[model samples]
Target: MANQTKADRAKIFMPFDAVKGFREALAEKERIIVPKTELSEERKEELDRRLRMIHTGDIITVVYFHDGEYVKLTGMV
Candidate 1:
């Protein structure tokens, strides 16, 4: 044991996962699939107006959908 390298000792203490891929499968199943909402004409116009108001060097926040989720981020433009 004393002669074993650090890498060898680390490998000996590594946990054994018997249910490989189970966690990922379970998370996929548990995830809620939300249907994307369609913007109304009035809503679209409002959004367009707000977008045009933004200019360079402005700090803003945006909300958008990605990969089955709605994400919001704030940063400088």
Candidate 2:
């Protein structure tokens, strides 16, 4: 048997995830689907004004409800 230190021996028990889609495939098989959400009339009008106010070369962070959660994403206009 080869002489190995604690760090070297610890690596032997680490998980191997080299296969690209294996984890995603397993997650999809067990994922719970969430219904989509719609904005209210007042909320829609509020968002419209915010959109119009954003001019060229403006950066914005958009917050919306999706998949039973509030997701925030940033992008440049």
Candidate 3:
């Protein structure tokens, strides 16, 4: 009705978060995390040698485990 104020009309359109905190819980569930890897002395040496060979401007791809799955990122070093 023309007599209704904006605040009164707005109540009809108000929304509620019925499933509050569920999305946050789902986000926590899907968030990627992995345990730190332990490298053997020989393996560490090999990786150190490879890292020392790269220049600052070189491009490289890093592959590692996240939540037990391998994730890759490509970028310039």
Candidate 4:
């Protein structure tokens, strides 16, 4: 221990997942599979109108579905 370098000491405390792949498997099991819903004609028209109103520099928040989940992201258009 007395002769160990700074880099060697840092390596001793490095983080690691004790249970490999266990967290991911648990998360996958907890996730509910949701079916995608079809949008009605009126709903589709409303979404189209809102999309057309967005400009290049506008800041917008959008909810989109990916991998069986709806994620909301806010950023500049």
Candidate 5:
């Protein structure tokens, strides 16, 4: 029998009013995840299409904030 292992996770932080800068940072690392807005049906469809490509065991890094204060970053594999 084979043994199963859990994935890894991480968290980081960046400035809030630095959206463009954030993208530049990701680009430099050769990795990124741009969020898709769900403002309309068309946008939702686009997001769905993009998300469909994501799969398990794939690494995902999420950027956000805690208590709407400091910027919070996290990653899952």
Candidate 6:
């Protein structure tokens, strides 16, 4: 028999406010993964430096996953 390991899953409590503005609910909760890009070396360096300067609770814009679409949106700041 092959060895099998149990997978762990995290429960994400997406607040009601997160879905309030959307016309569709289930269509807005999809999986999204974005990789950091290196378009310009100078800009990338600046962003990295600024990221290190930010404090906890500071917000940033990221990709929002929908049922089949990914949208870029701004969150808390």
On lDDT, the candidate that comes out on top is 4
Model 6 over residues 1-77: C-alpha lDDT tens digits? Answer: 13433332222333445556574655445444455443598877987897787776778776645544567886665
The TM-score-based order of candidates, best leading, equals 4, 1, 2, 3, 6, 5
Q: Write the per-residue lDDT of candidate 5 for residues 1-76, one digit (tens) a residue.
A: 1343333222223335546577778765764445533258886697678678778787765444343333446565
Could you estimate the TM-score for every candidate? Answer: 0.59, 0.51, 0.48, 0.70, 0.31, 0.32
The digit string of per-residue lDDT tens for model 3 on 1-77 reads: 99999999998898765798987899888876767688899999998999889999999988877766568899998
Encode model 1's per-residue lDDT on 19-62: one tens digit a residue.
99987899889887777878999999999999999999999999
Error of 6 at 4 (Å): 46
The parts of candidate 5 lying over 4 Å away from their true place are: 1-38, 62-73
Higher-scoring candidate on lDDT, 3 or 5: 3
Winner by TM-score: 4
Alpha-carbon shift of residue 77 in model 4 (angstroms): 1.1
Q: On a 0 to 100 scale, what is the lDDT of residue 7 in model 5?
A: 30
> How does candidate 4 fare on TM-score?
0.70
Model 6, CA-based lDDT? 0.59
lDDT, model 5 = 0.55
Error of 5 at 30 (Å): 32
Cα lDDT tens digits for candidate 4, 1-77: 89999999999898887899988999899888787778999999999999999999999999888888777899998
Query: What TM-score should be assigned to candidate 5?
Result: 0.31
* Candidate 4 lDDT (Cα, 0 to 1): 0.91
True-structure Cα RMSD, model 4: 3.3
**Alpha carbon lDDT at 69, candidate 4:** 78
